[model samples]
Target: MHEDTAYPLYNRPWFSVWLDAGGNITMKGILAPAIKPFTSDLLDLFENEKPIGTIDANGMIVADGEQLIFSTWMPPIPSAAFDRLTRSQFNARLGKNTPDQVTISVTEECPNRCIHCALPDTDNRESLSPDAVKDVIDQVIGMGTT
Candidate 1:
């Protein structure tokens, strides 16, 4: 059994029968009969046009035969770091849509003391207030839209 934690589900030993262009069934491996019924149900669920069951708020597999294609929890609101990452990824895909952008780092609480840091090396570090951070984000968003 493939008991690796990385593949949370489908980490158990399962069999797959491959059929080539010609109609032929070749058994790959044998799994417990107890697992067979669940596997068939899962396949049916995925094959259907619409999802078979509902997904709970916590994002767990709440019901059998429920296929979860994609899920994400939206953060309370976008932080500067979050905005920057989103902008960068968007710019990479849609270069024409994204204008040339500059970033003003709001804080320097980096744990790693990189030698080439532009900020002064002092144990005492200051961060922008919540209001100041909000203003900076608003300005950036305005600039981005223009």
Candidate 2:
């Protein structure tokens, strides 16, 4: 089981999800404008000593002069069992929690036309499958490893 957090559900493991005090959820693209490296140690956010928006007494997101409105809270990725998913990205396990960066190169087909090549005789060349490797990279980057 993952650790339960009291910080009102503004999680980044999945894309931005902002749940307010009235049980409302907003799936705004909050990443770009947000303070980077969200330490998750505070209930509020700030920018240049100015309160951008957020952290009401009940942890509701308060955008000045703007009424937060959204009828439904949709998960970025839908799930099968639950009618509503929480902020933990369905509790998906994370990669190593280290300040580490890695570059991964995947080889699809044998380059050398040797006996070890499965289809050496034919002209078979395979490039990196981006979609296939994206999930891996996402998980890795999610761990705060660039």
Candidate 3:
């Protein structure tokens, strides 16, 4: 149910996805590149700016007995007729494997009353438990977030 529209799919050049040791799949990436007219309609649907389609293109859930396995998608070739340059581009981008930025809000409340803040509201906000904060910091550090 998470939705962020500040960044649109037409602006990004790449994305990165990975799964944590606890089986928690975290996908943090830039907006997707635009679709060209030459692209397949089926694949174009996957690249749409709408959340439903974009999420489908970026995420997957597999049912395995009692467990729900989750993962993200890599760039898919539209067809064998696709040019060699485009195929090589996909390979190069996918091979540029690195960690994306990890943003964790330890506290929703900021004592300062700054006018430039984007928070919907600053009052009576809930903060994460100390142990939870510690855990998140440790996890992000281990994941190599810069």
> Each candidate's lDDT (Cα)?
0.40, 0.38, 0.37
Per-residue error at 5 for model 3, in Å? Answer: 46
Per-residue accuracy of model 1 over 23-107 as CA lDDT, tens digit each: 2223344664544554454333223133223333554545431223221321111224334433443454555354335456567
RMSD in angstroms, candidate 1? 16.3
Deviation of model 3 at 28, angstroms = 34
Residue range with the least summed lDDT across 10 consecutive positions in model 2:
75-84
Residue 62 CA displacement from its true place in model 3, Å? 54
Model 2 agreement with the true structure over 1-146: per-residue lDDT tens digits: 01121122344554555444233334445452453334332222211122123323453555421222222232111221111223233232243235334555455465666675556666646666878679777786565443
Q: Rank the candidates by TM-score, best first.
A: 3, 1, 2
The TM-score measured for candidate 3 stands at: 0.28
Off by over 4 Å in 2: 1-99, 108-128
Off by over 4 Å in 1: 1-99, 120-124
TM-score of 2: 0.22
Model 3, span 31-128: residue lDDT tens? 32343322333234333233222222334432211111222222212212122323444444557433444556677676765686655464558889
Error of 3 at 84 (Å): 32
Scored by TM-score, the top model is 3
